[model samples]
Target: MINWFDIRDYGAVGDGTCIDSPAINRAIQAAAAAGGGAVCVPAGIWLCFSIRLASHVRLHLDAGAIIRAAVPGAMGAYDLPEPNPHNMYQDFGHSHWHNSLIWGEGLTDIAITGPGMIDGHGLTSKGPGAKWAKRKGYFPESMAGMSAAELAAEDPEEAAMQGQGNKAVALKNCTQVTLSDFTLAKGGHFAVLATGVDHLTISRLRIDTDRDGLDLDCVRHCVVSHCRINTPNDDAIVLKSSLALGQVRPTAHVRIHDCHVSGFDPGSMLDGTFRRTQDKAPDQDGMTGRIKLGTESNGGFHDIEITSCTFERSRGLALETVDGGMLTDIRVSDITMREITTAALFIYAGARMRAPEGTPPGGIRGVRIERVRATDVDPRFASIIAGQVGTPVRDVVLSDIDITYRGGLAALNVPVPEKPDAYPEPSMFGPLPAWGLFIRHAAGLRVQGATLSTTQADGRPALWLDDVEAVHFEQVDLNNAAATPPLVCRDVRGLTGEMVP
Candidate 1:
C-alpha cells in the first residue's frame, strides 16, 4: 500500500455516520500550516459538517469512503469572516458563504479525488430549516432580527434565501483545480459550481442531482469532458457569468466535449434569477432540458466549443442571451438527442440584461449549430428557433441537422394581447410557439442540409421562418403526412430553398 494516510501525522477520522468536520478540518488546517499535504479520508462513512480546504491540500477519499453532511444546521459552524465595510449588504451579491455543501476559496492545486462517493443528502436537506428553504423568499428571515453590521458578521446565508444555499460543491476564486473520477449524488443546488477559477479540468465524473449537475460561472480557460450527468431540475451542464448588480468580468475560453446528459426535470430549470427586478415583467416558465445558457448572463461569454455529446429526454437546446450579455464565437457539433419535449434548438438574441437604470442593451452574435440530430420531439415545438426578441440574432448557421417531430410545428413569436378587463396590465403572454424550423428576427442565417419529419396525426408545416434576413436553405427536406405547408416563411429577404416552400 502507498500509505496515503495522513491521520497518523495530522489525523482526522469520521465513520461516515458521525460529525467529523471539526477533526478533519483541524487536521487539514494543521497540514496546510505545516506546508500542505493530503488529508486522507479512508474507507468508511463519515458524517461531517462542511469542511473548508486549505491551500495545496488534497482530500483523498479511498474506495468505499463516503463523507456525508452531518445535519443542515451545522453549515453555519465555520462561517467565513465578514468582509470589511461593516455593512451587511456590501458583499451580499458576491459572498460565497451559506451556498455550498463542500466549499473552498483562494486555494491552489486542491482536489477531492477518489473512487468513492460524496452523497449530499439533498432530499434530507431541502425544506425550511433546511439550507435551500431559507433562501426561497426575497428577504431572509435572519436579516429581520439583525443590524447591517451584524448581518455581515453572520454567514451570507443568514441574509440570503435558501434557494441560493443548496449547492453541493463550490470552489470560488481558486486556480489550477481538477475534479475527476467521482460520483456526486443528490445535490441540493448545483452538483459542482466553479467560479472565478482558471485552468480547471472536470472529467470522467458522474453527477446525479435534482438541481443543476455542473454549473460553471465566471470561470475561464476550463475543459469538461467524458462525464455523465442526470438531474431532474435544471440543465445538466451550464456556463454563466455574474448577473448581479456589480460587473464581474465574463468567463471565457470554455470547452465541453464527449459527455452524456439526460433525465433532467424540464419544468423547474431556470437561469439568471440574480437579475430579477421588481419593475420587469413576470417570466414565462417552460420546460428546459440538456444544454442552456443564461437568463443571468451579464458577464458575456466567448470562445466556447461543445462537441461529441448526447442528450436524452430533455426539453431542448436553449441558448438565451436575455440578461444583456454577448455570446460570441460559439460552435456546437456532432450531437444526438432523444425524446425532446420542446424545440430541438433555440437561440434568442433579444435577451436584455436589466441594466442599472441607464445602460445600453446587450446582444448575442456569432453562433453556430451543426451536424446535430434529434428524434421523437413534440411537434408543437420546432426543430430550431433562432432570432432575437427585438434585436436580430446575427451570424447564425445551422448545417447537417436531421430532426423528427412527433407533434406538429408551431410558431414561437405570436404576440398575445392582454384582456382589457383583466388585472390593470397584462399578467401573462401567450406561448411563443414554433415549427420544425422557426427563424425570426435574425440576420445572416444559413440552413444547409437540414431534414425534418413529423409523425403526428395532425398535419402541420415542418418549418416556419418569420422576419428573417439573408437566409439560405439548401438541400432541405420536410416530410409530413399533413396538407399544411411543409415550410412557412414570412417577411424574409433572400431566402433560397430547393425543396422547401
Candidate 2:
C-alpha cells in the first residue's frame, strides 16, 4: 500500500563516527521518487551534517533513534545558505533555510513524526543585534576600528558559525506540514523555524534547547499543541511576522493550546535536572522562555487563540507589534505562571517601523486575555499596556486575572519615556510608575474581576492611567499593597471604575 525506505538500505552506518546524512538524503530522495512514502530512520546514533527533506515525504524516526548533528566542518558541512538580498529585513537565521540540520523549502505534504531525539550539540547559534550586524552590513559604533581577527576573537560563536548551519529544523514556504512526538535537545539557534507556511501542525514535542524553541514567522492556519519547551536563553514559542519572504504575509488563524513553557537550563529538562544554573541570557536579562507575539511585526497577526498553557521560571505572555504590524482579534485564556521575570501580561504597540519604507505604524485592537493566574512575578513591570502618542492601542480586555507581585520598589512619579522607535520588551520602560497595572496611550480597555496583590509593600498606586480614554474597571481588588492613592490618573478621559483598596 505504501512505500518504505530505510536508511540502512541506502548505505547508512549509524556508528556515531560516520557521516550519515548523505545516505539519509538518499533514502528521502528514493521515497520522494517513489511518489510519496516514509523514510525510516531506525534506532541508532546516526551522526549527520544536514539531512534535506522533500515533498510528500514523512521522515519517521523510531524510538531510541538519535540523529546527532555534527559540528560544521568536523566531518561534513551543511548546505550553503542561499542568497537573499532581503535578508536585512530580518535576522540572518530567519532569511536562510538551507543552512540547517534539517530543511525544506517550497514543498507540500511533508512531516517529521517520531519519538526519536535530535541532539544538536555541535551546532552554533546567535540571535540578532550587533553580533549579527556584520552579516547584514551593519556595524555599530562600538566596534569602531577593530581588526577582523580581533572581531572574530570578541564573538567567537559568530566566527564559528560562518559558512555553517545553526538551526535544528527549518522549513520555508511549505504547505501541509506536521511535526510531532520528538525530543529536541540543545537545538542550536532555533529548534524549529517555520516561515511562510500554511496548515502547519506541531504537537507533543519536548524541546529543551539552547535558544529559541520555535519561531513561527509569517505562518498561516497553524496549530501548536501539547508541547513542553524549555529555553533559558530565548523565547519558548514565539510567533513572528517578519519580512523574511519579501512580502507582507500576516500570520493568521493560529491556535496554540495545552503547552508548557519554561526557562530551565539547557538539556536539563530531558535529564530531569531542571537546574537554574544559567543566570542570564545573551541579552544579559533573566531567563526568557515564554509564549510571545512579535518584535518582528512586518506582517500583522489576526484571529489567534492561545489557551491552557503554563509558564514556569520564565517571562510572562507578551503581545508586541512594534515593527508596523497590526495585532487584532487575539484571545488568550487559562494560563498559570510562576517565577516570572517580566510582566505577568505585557502588551505594546509602537512605531519602530523596521519594515520597508512607506509602511505605516501598526496598532493593537480587539484583544481579550482572561483566566490568568501568576505568582512571584517581578513588580518592576507589572502588567503593562502601552502604545505610542498618536497610535493608541484600542479595545482590549483583561478579565479574571489574579496576580501576586514580588514587590520592592520605593519610587513615585517615575518619569516614563515615549520610546516610539525602541525595541519592544516588557522591561523597556525602566520601573513602571504603577505597581499593579500601568495603562498609557490606550482606548476602550476593560478590566473585570482582577485581584492584585504584592508580597512586599510598594509605594506606587495600584492602578495608573495616562492618556487613556473609555477605560472601565469592575470588581477590581488591590489587596495588600494598594498605595495611599489607590488610583492615579493623568490626561485620562471617560474613566469609570470601582476600585476596592
Candidate 3:
C-alpha cells in the first residue's frame, strides 16, 4: 500500500516566500496518521523554518526542488525541541538540534532522500546570524557575537527565530535511518548530525558545507559510503563519542568507504565548479578536510574500518582517543592522499580526559594500516604514532605504505610537547623529529615493505624511534640523501633491522 501526501495539497506555497513548514508538518502528520508513507515535496523553492520529522515518514525532495532555510528574522516560526541542559558539556554547535532546519529525536524508520537539494540558506559556522553575510572566498564578514552565558540566556525560540541555523539535519536516539541522493549546500555546523543512532545508512550525498560534512556521535552499525564532501571549514567525515547524552556511549561498528573528501572552495563541488580558494581557507593552517576520530571523545571508537577513500588538499587521517576511552581493532586500507598538509597517518593517545575526574588515560591498540600511498606530504612533520609516557599504544602494524614528502632544509630542533591534558591535534606535537616516520612511546610496532622518499634535500633522518619497544622493520626502504642516515635511534629498546639492536 502506497500512502503519499503532497505538500502543495496541504497549502504549501512553494513559490519560495511562503512559510511552508506548517504545510509540510501537516502533510507529515497526515502521512504518519495513515501509518507509514512518503511526504513528498514537489519541484519548487520551499523556504521553510524547522521541519520536524516523524517516524515511518520519509521526506522526499523531487528534482529541481529546494528546501531552503528561512533567514534569522523569520527564525521564530520554526519549532524548537526540548532544551537539554547537559549540552553545555560539549561545543556550542553540538549542544542543540531544535535550531536546525530539519531535526528528529527518538524516532525510527525515518529517511530524507531525493535528487533535490536542502540549502541551509541561513546558517553560519560562527557568530550570531552569520548566514546573513556572504562568504567572499574563505572568511565571511564578522557578525554580532554572544558569550556562552548570554547565548544560554536567550529564549530558545528567540535564538532560532533571530539567530542563524546551526545544522541542516539533526537526529538523536534514532534507528533505521536512511539519508541519500541529496545535495546539501552551506550546511552550518554539520550537514547531518546523528547521535546515538543505530542501523543508519548514509550514501550518495553531496555536501559542500561550511563546517563538518557529517558527524556520527555514539552511533553504531552505520555505513557512510559513496559521498562527495567539500568542507573547507572543518572535517569531512568524523566519528565521535561525545558526552552529549549525559552518559558514556561509544561509536562502534562503523564503515566509511568509497568517499571523496576535499578541502576545495565552497559551493564549487555542487555547481560543477571545483574552484580553489587557497588563500581564504579556514584554520590557522590550510587544513580543514579529512576524516577524524576525535576531539570530543568520552567513550572511544571500536571496530571501525575506513577503505577506498581519496583525500586531496586536506589533512591526513587521524585516530585519537584522549578521554579515558578504549580505541581498538581499527583497519584502514587502499587509500590515496595528495597535497597532504600534514602527516599521512596520525595516531595519538593522550590524557585529555574530558570525562569525569579520576578517569584514567585512554589507549589505542590492534590497529592496521596498509596499501596507503601519500604524495607531497609536509616534510617538517612526519607521520606520528605516539602514546603518553609509560602508556604506550600497542600492536600497530603498517605494511605496503609509500609516502613522498616535500623536503626543505630543516634545522631539526623543534621539541614535541607532551600536552597530555590539553587538546589533541596533529600539530599540537609541533615539528616532528623525523622527515618520514616518527614513532614514540609505543610497543609491539611492526613495519613491513614500507618506503619513504623526499622531493628535495632533507636534513632529518628518514625514521626516528624514541622509547619504542618490540619494534621490527622488515625490508623497509628509506630513500634519503647519502649524507642523512636512514634511521635515528634514542632510548629505543628491542629494535631490529635498520637500527642496531
Instruction: Judging by lDDT against the true structure, name the best candidate.
Output: 2
**Better model by lDDT: candidate 2 vs candidate 3:** 2
List per-candidate RMSD values in Å: 8.5, 3.2, 5.5
**Tens digits of lDDT, candidate 3, 1-501:** 768899999999999887788899999999999998999999999998888999999999999999998875733544443566655345656666777889999999999998999999776565222121221111211111445464443223334433466789999999999999999998877888999999999999999988899999999999999999998768999999988887888899999999999888888888887787663344455656899998677788999999999998888899998878889999999999998877779998987666665778889999999999999987777999999899999999999998999887664866666777656656666677788889989999999889888888788888888889999998788776636777887788898755321
The C-alpha stretches of model 1 lying farther than 4 A from their native spots are 1-11, 73-99, 122-165, 264-289, 384-386, 408-434
In TM-score terms, candidate 2 sits at 0.94
Q: Over the stretch 395-444, how does candidate 2's per-residue lDDT look in tens digits?
A: 99999999999877776665887777766777767788888999999999
lDDT of each: 0.63, 0.86, 0.82
What lDDT score is found at residue 444 in candidate 1?
A: 83
| True lDDT of residue 381, candidate 3 | 73
In order of listing, the candidates' clash counts read 27, 0, 2
Between candidates 1 and 3, name the one with more favorable lDDT.
3
lDDT of 2 at 215: 96
Model 1's alpha-carbon lDDT is: 0.63
